[model samples]
Target: MGRKAIYTRVYNQLRYEILSGEIAIGSPLPPERKLAEQLGVSRNTIVRAYSELEAEGFIVSRMGSGRYVEALHPAPSHAQTHWGKQASGKLAAAPSHMAELLSVTDTYPNTINFAHGDGGKHTLESSCFSDYVKSTAEQLHSYYFTSVQGLPELRERLVAWMDMEPISSPEQVVITSGSQEGLYLITSLLARPGDLVVTEMPTYFGSLQLFQSLGVQIIPVPMDANGMRIDVLEGILARYRPRFLYTVPTYHNPTGWTMSLDRRKKLLALSERYQLPIVEDDAYRHLHLDAEPPPSLKSMDRTGNVIYLNTFSKLLFPGLRVGWVAANRSFARLLTRMKELSITTNTLGQLALAAYLRDDALRPHLQEVRKQYAEQAAIMAGHLDRFRPLGIRYERPAGGFYFWVSLPEEINPRQLMTECLQQGVSFTCGDMFLLREAEQPYIRLCFTHERTDQIDRGMKIIDHVLQSRKELLS
Candidate 1:
């Protein structure tokens, strides 16, 4: 073959190896002379191939060492070839934008973090948690691995805990790392490429990522103050016959709009009629500020229609990484096996959390959390009320960490996010929750993550920056 043909063959082979995950990321390629000898090609041909690969961004040449795969993509533009892109059409375009908000927090140590959904400064007391750790450690004599379904005691405790939510027995529960894992496991079992999954328009971003990763087609159902629009959902249900309905019925993440009793019943009724199961992610159920929200769909479900997902991450600490999925006995067993095949649940944390729950500490702690977040939410609302004329629209969240605020159409959310970060405050842009093409004149700010003092300062900064932008647009 000609020298050009030899180099082209070499380049194609190397590119295929890198993209197909055969060579592996960060692993060094053989020396040019060694590779030339191995491939039965001239060293110059191998050098030409390496140079092209480096230029294309498929590999990088280190000064002292050999060439290594920098990324699987040929270029930043070629990154659209991610497994998610091939499997699912719509990708969460917000991670890049959201990273900017996260970066501000990392870069500016004192930057009030309004973007993250985490327990604030006054999180669980160290002494209280230490006590549980001490007690749980004492009880756990062996350091060996436990069941993938999680610690028996933890599952039993969860069963009792779930009784209030009216979820089924311990037999129906399969413990997972977090509700995130539960979502993944269930999605793996049910959804496949080209399958349809329905969700609220401004649903949890994590759920969207999971669905997109599986190559499932996501059909968003619009929501109002009563939560997901059942009227709109009925039309989609009649036409599409989705795989499952994913929703956060109580104190939703971004909007904090709880599904009303009427809507909840209708949603369940539709699920029953269509034989569609519901994945009820009740992550923020305990964070209600004012009054109790409506009963969860799981609680109301008469048939084995709702797969209930609950997590300790929101109310409790995130590091614990304990969550559970409650379904019918048959599905519960399947989930338990799925957990076994994939990864085991956190044993130490589960034991510790079980010990903590045994004392019924969560209720009292939840009361404190409710009071603190309520105060913080009210403080933020008061400040935001002053800036209402700037076209900042929101329904004051009765509970949960976030206030989903809608900006004026003229004001670009990305521009506002950039200016806010510059002024020592940060929030997630609306585009983070939806596709880039979707018109998202919105932003989500977390009140629970910041202290009362920080909320005031942060809101003032946001107010000043946004008011200036509004005036410019005017």
Candidate 2:
């Protein structure tokens, strides 16, 4: 065989091993001469093959050490062939932090996890969810693909479920795998690289991750008690012509500050005046612990400017991976086409969700969840309030799972996280949510997952940590 053919053969074998997990990531490859001898090829052939793997991002070479498989796999090379550069970029830039957050730390006995967003002990019945999938598969019996816009009945059900002022039509609703996919679709289609996208300060980190991957510039507008400051947003609008504004107005993540109705209206007016599109992410709107949240921006929108994204992930179950985007008829149609091209929605799951929604099962379930979360939130707030005199501050969120807490300026947030983990407690670092590094110390805790008793214990652990730090300083 030709020398080129020999190297190609060796390269393909190495690539297959890496992709198939036979060659674990970060494991060193055999030395060039050793590998060449084993494969009955020249050292030059091994060198060329290694270079090929490195170029494609499957492996890397260290200065003194041998070649090692990359820890993070590159996007499938076939993505550009099938979809385009956008698809490739999306897959390649999948956030590393998400993987860290999703790891199976559950195996660690006695570890109190507050890092994840999902229902901790309150997660839905797996057997029932399996039944939904099985029943739908057996009964529905459609060998063909479902509509890209989503199963028709599901779209209709979602529109009725949300019950916005303007009343969305079935045609205006496009189903997505989840809110993450919806955000990705919007970001990919609406704005290109170098375009500006404005977001609230300390906005959803997931959104920030997507924006950064897309090469879109994110301008953060500071938030207050009401929500994203309209005055600050106006200043940004005047100076920079951003392509769109993204906000989690109701039951804001991390901080849990719901936007006041007045601010919502002002935001709508600003969007109208600026002719800027608003991507309103109301993922946690239904998880309201106390009163209902203010009218959604999409509901308040007179023009076809607000693209509303909602998910059942936080409320019902995230594993089902079902969500929807509501927009004007034309844009929604465009999104449907995009969905069709980007790995069509899960047919069986959508049908099951539709059946669940149609039977009016979600409301009763939400009522129970609301009560539980409310109790948990109060317990968490009470503990923090006890530590209030120590300069630790937080807003008692009206509704939502997270408590965004600020520690005393003297304590380092990273150091505090390490200490908390050592004490068998884990929480999200607040800087993960921000577009830039923040000056003061902040952290996010999800109270929804832990049992109230466990939460109390965890809070006491945290309090002890704070008190110890204070003592050291004195």
Candidate 3:
């Protein structure tokens, strides 16, 4: 056989052994002359094979010692494939802080988990959700396929209740599996790789992760209580041409700060001037504890720039993964096509929610939920006085599931999280929501998921941990 063929054969064998774990990492490979003699090949063939392995990062050569296995694998040669080397990076990059963020930190004792946005728990008080599901299921039409836009009945129902005035026609809506899919569709389609997009700093981590996975650059604008700083956004728009701007305007996630009406007007003005499209995620809009939130961007928009995304899951059913996008006729049609390409439709969820809405059951049920959440928010807030003494400051959220609390820089948020978890308590650390994970002096607390008593218990535990952390400092 040719010398090239002999070296190539040796290279393949070594590569297989390293990848299969037979050649353990850090173990020394046989010396070149020894390996050549054992395999009945020339020393030059062994040298060539070892060079191949070293270049691929499967092994490393150390002077005076010998070549040792450095890695079983190297960076993917095919970024397109989705297996061993084929798959995992795109999905794996999502929510890297899931253990600390999602409250699945493997604590043995019963944990008061505050990591997830449990819209599911809030709906336990719901009365007629099951009835509508049963009724809708009994009908054969509910089982049949609907339009790419969604069921006409469902779209019509959404139009009637949508806070936005732009949704005057069913043709202007596209039903998605959930608002999350709406985000994915919008971001993936509008912003290609290497393109820039704008987002609020400490915004939804899901969007941050999605953008990073897609190789999209995020221009994070810091927000105040009034919402996305229009002044900063104005500068960003002037400087960099982003594909779109994403905001959770009403009763925002992580931090329950709503955008003021004045800021909303200014934002729309900017959008009009620059012709930038806005993707407004209004998931928590219906959870207002007191007066209704200011008019949504879509509602205030005169120009067809705002693409409104909302979900029914948070309303009265968490498992009900039905959501819709309200946009201009042109954008709506494009989103409909995107939906068709991604997820066809959630027919059963749409049918059930539509039937429930048709009966006008949502309004009363929402009021009850608002009251329940308000009470829960208060219960959690009542404990804040205890936390304030420990360098922990938090604003009592008027609506939404979270209280974006600020901890002291002196204290590490992850350490606090670790101590809390050891004591059967769990909450999201602040850094999880940032574009870059660091020791951020903020933590997000959810009050709507647990019962009032559980919420109270969790707070006491957190307070105790904070006190301990503070005492240690002194």
Candidate 4:
């Protein structure tokens, strides 16, 4: 077996032995060399597995003696039927990696975090926001539910702010809880269970989870440096008809590669020819570091086939939970009607965000994030220079929060992440963004959520882990 396979197998077997009471509590485990020889693996592999067990509190090492198993008081087993057999298929379709994703972004107790998907988390919090939120709520003397279509004033403000002429208007907008809700609404409207939809291979994992939960089968189209390969898309289109095509396009999530203008235009031409509906998720459009990207796919469409979704989360903050969909008035109206299935959108958030935009806060905020995030990205790039010699590959993004790196074949991605976590750094593995797991390792590091100081610490720990793993393989 390979190192990863052998290590995992040995670790799991030892754990099972302990849990099954075969390896009694407080008993001394076999020495490293003995275990390695018995398992037909290298001593380093045995050491790695034992180190994990020690870190997880399954065993402990004595001063000069050897490792011994610790007492693990098992929880009392309850006699009741398991829930899986009775659960719906959609619930079963929900993937397990989401729990891992949450550990990095939400639950993990890490010293430095680079796995958070959202940016502006640190920069956007303030007493000023608190005051604005309070004032907005105070101005609403009576408790009235926001419309299903969202607060009218917010919709009007969004139309003016977007500045997409001719095609966009207040009536063409449907306010949503977040861009995520917009994705759900679009999927519900256009696609059904067992339906196929086209997406970039390494697209946003969040979207992949949602689609799978809704019983949608994804047909992933591979991407290149310039973004999704149009030629492959054409072949897919010729073979099977997907309900819609979803893309991040500008400063795409996970990969951070923007679609070239030429490809964007070609994609539009193909969309018109195939009559394909495209979902333009413009979450990071305003977060560029250098030059501005080309116009959004929605702005170029005259056929009204593109459903454009935008969020204030990336620009302002995620907790604000305000986003919108811009489509033709007819489609927008349908979305608004469908939204009645859920409760009215958060009115306080809508009113507060509209007021913030009314004060013209967006322009200055954009400029500020552009500068702050650019510096953060540069700091990470400088630190990542150490890995280039180790066959790590990445291109610093022009904009967006993540750095997508393809790691050397010598390293095991899951093992690397676990060891790095033990050293107090966290980042998302690349397989999380795909429809399936990957053989060669890839990872997405988000820089905008952490400051320059934390970036230095996180990258240094990652560098150390990479070097150690490389040596072990050697």
Best by lDDT: 4
Candidate 3 error regions (>4 Å): 1-94, 97-109, 120-122
Q: Return the clash pairs for model 3, or none.
A: 81-86, 82-86, 82-87, 83-86, 83-87
TM, every model: 0.78, 0.78, 0.80, 0.81
Candidate 2 backbone overlaps, count:
0
Q: Ten consecutive residues with minimal summed lDDT in candidate 2? A: 71-80
- Clashing residue pairs in all predictions, respectively, total 0, 0, 5, 0
Q: Write the per-residue lDDT of candidate 4 for residues 1-474, one digit (tens) a residue.
A: 577998887886776455333454456898999988988889998999899888766789998999987643211123435674444544425555656666664555655888776664567753246656888878763257878898888889988888887455688999988898999999999998778788876788878888877878676676777988787788668767889999999998889999999999999998999999999999999999999989999888888889999987788777777889999888899899888998777888888878878888778878877888999999999977778998899989999899999899778777888888878888888768765454446888999988788899889999988988888888
For candidate 3, what's the RMSD?
14.4
Off by over 4 Å in 2: 1-95, 104-110, 126-131, 140-144, 165-167
Highest TM-score scorer: 4
- lDDT per residue as tens, model 1, 1-474: 587877877886776555433454456899999999999999999889899878876779889987876532211222555666743344323234434544675787777888888776576662276677777677654255777777788788888887744454677888888888999999989877668788886777777656765666666666778898788778767766678989998888778898899999999899999999999999998888888877778888888899999898897776678888998888899998889886687667777888788989888888888888889999999987887887778999877888989887678788888888888887887656642223357789999888899899999999888878877877
CA RMSD of all predictions: 15.2, 15.2, 14.4, 12.9
Model 4 quality (TM-score)? 0.81
lDDT of each: 0.78, 0.79, 0.78, 0.80
Error of 1 at 30 (Å): 60
- Candidate 3, run of 10 with poorest lDDT: 71-80
The clash number for model 1 is 0
